[model samples]
Target chain A: MSKQYLTTHTVDEAHPTEIFSVSPTPSSLFSASGSSALQIHSTTKGGFPLQQTITNAHRLGCHHVCTSRGGVGNVAASVGFGGEIKIWARQGSELLPQHEANGEWELRWEIAPTQTNGGDVWAVALSADESYLACTTSDGRIHVWDLTARERIQSYETGGSGTGGSFAMAVDLSRDGKLTATGHESGAVYVFNNNSGRLAYSLSGLAKSVRAVAFSPGCKRLAAAGDAGVIAIYDMERGEHVSNLSATSSRPAWITSLDWNDTGEYLLSGALDGKVKVWDVARGVCVATHSETEGALWSVRWLPKNERALEPGMGKGEMFCAAGANKSLTFYREATGI
Target chain B: MVRFPGQTVQETRKFEALFCILELAHEALLSGNLITLRNIYYQNMELFVSQAVVNVMIDSLASTLGVGRWDLNIGILLPSINSIEKIDFHSVKWVLVIEKEATFRTLAASQYHQTSKAGHGILITDANRLPLSQGARARLNSGSQRDRPTKRSRTDRGGDPVASITNKPFLQKAENRGVTSLQQSISTEYPEANHLGHEQRLEEELVHGVNENAISHHGAGDPVNSTMTLTQTDRKKVVSILNEICTGEGTVCTAVSMEQKQELQRMLVLNIKAEIQAVDHFGDITKWLDEKLCKW
Candidate 1:
């Protein structure tokens, strides 16, 4: 029998309008609010207690939040409507002051430029190691920054400008950094060579804006989905459409997020209608459907796989988290042994 | 020689004894009636090994029992980390995204909760806190300064062992889609990397639906943005006129004659087409054509 458990924690009514972004720590979860403040809550049941709160985090509401790829033990980054991106490193769950540069914690510390123009940063993505930070702007450009150097290294424009004009709404860097793919409002998905440093492919398929684009684990295939309500699979080598996937319930609702599994056999997508569907790429079928909430899901993520040598009774792999409108974070594990 | 059921001094005692014990254990485990075996093992402590050794023994026994190997197909639903870490093209094959933390945590911790007899190994971690790659590190590192973009060897990012792990995708799904901002390609300071046709093809396959049906309904089957013509002099004049007339204080002067409005519309459509042509992006521009022309 397939088993699924729904867990809910009542967070401090911190976010008045909506909880836009959330990040998970080992023992806790952090969330950003439309009220421009950042709050942390425990993940354990009856543990939705607000552990830490950063009031007035942004003069404007925070738009995005992300923890380092290293884990919640390290730094966390968030962007605001003010067009600024800030990193927050954990000093024992007490947010370390941005200026404090202690070495051990430095690797895990959060950062934000003391001064920035507030350029309307739309999206932010980090490397798995937490070494680099990339942000998309309303001006249709992607700026990659080195967290260690505190400098901007590469800037790739999506070739347009203005708010919602030709913005790079979504961007993902392949693990090896060989490729960079960005989904644009123009419904154009462009993949760049981070290594070769040139325009590689200008993908044109989605008739509507491409909201989410993800590269396979092997960086061989790219998956993108959006308003069309279909997940478009592409052969990274051929720059051609390999397949299009949609379930029976699939409609043209805007897909907000895309992620590839560890094995690259499945593709997961989150739609505006508060529905999550899993797609089997090899077989091209909907393997599962999960609907735990009706609130708009702002983000969906697979937990990092635990590859540490398995000890008896020790659990690793096949876990994921989803959070949004309700200001609560939910975790799910695979019920089947496989 | 140990004497037991269906065993004799001349019999193959090792195989028979082990098989009998395993069958008993299996029957007990399956029926949730381990008391018999528990009592027997308790009484004859020397007959069985420690639990750890027993687990291994049982694992081998279970495999030997002719049961099929457990096939675990891990799936994850996740989103955005492409900026900081590039997914290693070598590692994972599938992925999922979830909007809640409880969902992911419970799933990860469910190793203990799952009652399935077949054991499957799956890893679950926070999406934002996932592993990073070296190539992503270089790109991230190169941007420390606006003027000097740090350039690192791609191989360097791949050298780290952790980079290899995260290259694999995690699987999960959520109800509401995560907040995705616009994908803007507007900047001159930092140019995009070039991976030749590899990337182009990736995008085309992922973005452009080459399927006939997907292509057939495009822009009412007319390919609206297929043709556009506008000279630079005309574009410049149109911009100048719009800038002069659209000013906040007096921009809406006399509502402009319809003939001039028509002319302005023509100029605006051409300019919009030029702008559209100038950029590389996703989505169908045909739909945007009417909106752009209307705004013109």
Candidate 2:
């Protein structure tokens, strides 16, 4: 019940501008910021040393950078504020842009929103194997693109396309690659079947804007949080609202980001009040709260567990990193009394 | 006289009934569930004569526990909206007011806030035809008077001057100027490339490599520098070279030898990085080109 997470490291100046998103590869962390530079920091080292900086990676500045998890072959996809998507292939700690023989980086494919299209692409997610990419547009349309073929294979619409269509704020692809879930400004969470390309369930409960949606490790449950100030958990198998997770505080705070541990036992949330809370899902109670700053946290991610922790005698532990308006990446690990 | 000087039969019966109700309510609260006062009254109609008696017992129990009746997980039957007046709305962003019972039911059934565009607004309805509770009215008034903006700025927009300079033409001009200045500085610092013989020898070496099909198979088809089209056989040869480099294997004479495989991998990675940078640079320009073509 005490503070479960201890501040491990703080990169004071990770970005010259506000860092919007941070994606971790097996050995490195790639952060995209308001500046055009996409920086790679080595996670294997103690201080998370700056390994490389891809300058001018996004002319208009990058907003989101994501890497496929579950040993997904070191491929990453980044979305820039300029409405362009760039895919990078990792080789020896370097993320190189995919290109052709002409000494020019190839524009593998694009998801462009024209004046007549009535939608602007906002969020993107890649499959575990890096074979498929899913993105959400402003008009509540989710497009799944086949990376190998470089084409839009399927498009799922949430209806009300005209002025009524809500902006798709966040998206996540299931680890098994069978499902894609999206959260919208309309406070609706929709899950789609990747094979049939039909909506699996239209989840309801949270009425405020849903900023973040994530699938649990086993893919049996989905967690969503946003302006509603409470995290909503849905049973993925039955497509039913299971329970609502609320903080002990009577006053509500907008939740900006959510992440689940490897075992999915604890759900972590970062909110506008700069407080990061760990929720015990089974008990439906918040066990701990840590507030290090007052700046709103934009992104939080759980680092992949290392092999040493998997040893027989070692106790299970978890670590995560958070970044936002503070312009610094703070790493937190479970307090083990070391 | 045997019991006590102040304890009469009526007072003893009332105390017993209050104790029983408190015990039942405490059990319900301990189970982490809610119980209605009507249900408690029905459970022991003989002990408590009426629903009003059960409500009074619950209030007494709440006072004894030093908590509110709601905190004890007790709810009244058909509770009026006025009871929720004290519900906190300080952290809420917006409030939705509904006047019709049917409309409120429909909205509640569908979880209207999920589908409503209003972000994180509290939904309030006068379904019971009751007046607004004092607490609810105070919250509404204070919420409206508060000057806080509903949406938070996402990425430090006004803080950075460079981020505000989003004009494409101006950025392109600045980039060109920087490139020219860099070139001038390099030329002044290192004059070896300016020598006539060295420049000519480098060009001859590049031509010789192209003639031998060492680098031309891939470089000759560059859309930016070359107008020459590649034949099917040449294209096949180039694809084979790429496959060999990617797979780190070779079978025929066209394959990269073992000694050069590492060099080929390094070059491929560097080219990929450059190409990625180029794509970011031209991403917007390419979209403009597509728009122009579509217009035509």
Candidate 3:
């Protein structure tokens, strides 16, 4: 049976321009767009209020924003259209005496755009401990950096060899910190073993350009989606191809983002057609599908449920958020009575 | 004696915020009144700066105190009801306790109480008073007692900042709170008192804090916790507040530098607008509530 969901709240025109990316920590959602500033919406509050904003985060505007997937939520990294990656640290919102400084989300460091560091970093992911950072380049190379030392510790070549590999579109660090996975424009999804500094898996599933790759919370499964409009689940331990998640729609849209829930029981995906789907991992079914806008959806994420303040009759349920070309952020809550 | 000892600039501010929040929380716990984070934010806008600041502090304090969030008497505020005395439950038949604040707000705002049984009161309660979550209850089960350094020893060494307030006899405060008007019971005096409880006069240190935190710890086997984690620690525990209070050396950060207030203000330019809006809206919200709710 399909699980019923209700669109709880929508923040209209959250950004003046199309939102390009959205990521969530346990209590906050970081949203970035073609705007100079980055906005953070409080997921646990009413209407998901814009709790913080990092002004002039990117002079050229930002395209991607990602928070540490591990539970602590102490670190966040963002990519500007200028190809610069800025790292942010979550500090308790301190009362500062200035007209300008108002954010708890403070920028800690910046990696200036350069041909070095494996090519201009296109996508970035922070390890669970926030000690290591992994970034992908347009030349299909992935570089891992020890954040504390500010040094590139290892680099993996996707066979670009000074030319023609594929544009690395997405990257994610497994919560266990053992694996770093990336999706490339050549329809290639690669998993690198961080401990051994070797290529762990190169899977062929989506025949189209791969846009997103995410390691399940437990690190048991990896889900990837892109132009092929199909989500492929791969076994992380064995590097074997698993079941493909296909929608009943005749012309499926390119999936832009994928996130496995905290329990790994459910997967949340958003496509270019502005559709968000929740898939049950075990039963292999699209449990809930939502079409909030006809405009393209660039990103989607599952907001970590507020463990505190659960009222009576509020059976266990989930909450997820989506934002994109519509310039607004939409949040949906699982219909508990269902 | 001003040894913050190896703490970075950001940590110093975090501790400042922590101490500010704890002093207010200590007062709320003693006065026998519960306040939400939003409630705390409105009390001191200059200090908290924004609702988000208060939000961040609440989470950090709950994790640091090793106490329930409600144990801090901090929760989400309800905008529906201004007072309980105005609520006439005499004509009510069905008392509905709904889940989800949005639904509860909609139910209360839509005249659901009037339509229930065709003109009888439906006594909708403060949803914030809902039963504690499972994790919160397990934390309240009165974990085994272990001997620790005495507060007299710690305070004599001029180490513990919270020693003064949490040392008072908790029962006397509760009995004192019993005779006060309901408004006084729910109103807190901490934030307005000072940044820290030590600054408050000894004569005014009327309520016990951490012991009440412990009293509520043993309240699980009883249904007292059904009243939203409202339990007083054993009077002895209150008198010995620091004994089991600071667990895990208290809220250690893995390694992130904190920014100074001026630097934070500059970095958070976008948030300043929210702070302004919250200030302007505070009076309007109070006036709106007086017009919309108290009349009911």
User: Considering every candidate listed, which one attains the maximal lDDT?
Assistant: 3
lDDT of 3 by residue, B80-122 (tens): 2233333222453333332224334455656665754334434
Residue pairs with colliding backbones in model 2 are: A105-B275, A208-B120
**How many clashes does each candidate structure show, in the order listed?**
141, 2, 18
Kindly report which residue stretches of model 3 are placed more than 4 angstroms away from their true locations once superposed: A92-103, A160-164, A310-316, B1-296
**Residue A319 deviation, candidate 2, in Å?**
1.1
| Candidate 1: stretches off by over 4 Å | A1-14, A24-28, A41-51, A68-73, A92-119, A160-165, A306-317, B1-296
Report every candidate's CA lDDT: 0.48, 0.59, 0.61
lDDT (Cα, tens digit) per residue for candidate 3, span A138-167: 667888878778878998888745653577
| Per-residue accuracy of model 1 over A1-338 as CA lDDT, tens digit each | 22332332233345654566666544455677555578765443244456677776754456577654333335667875445677766554444433322222222333353322223466777765566777775446777878778887787766534223365667777765677788876778888877666778988878666767888878899988765668888888888988888766523445767777778886767665556666788888877667776645666665555544434432443655666555556555565454
When 1 and 2 are scored with lDDT, the better candidate is 2
What lDDT is reached at residue B149 by model 3? 26
Better-scoring candidate (TM-score), 1 or 3:
3
Runs in model 2 deviating more than 4 A are: A1-3, A92-118, A161-164, A308-316, B1-296
What 10-residue stretch in candidate 2 chain A is worst by lDDT?
A: A97-106
lDDT of 3 at B197: 25
| Cα displacement (Å) at residue B95, model 3 | 72
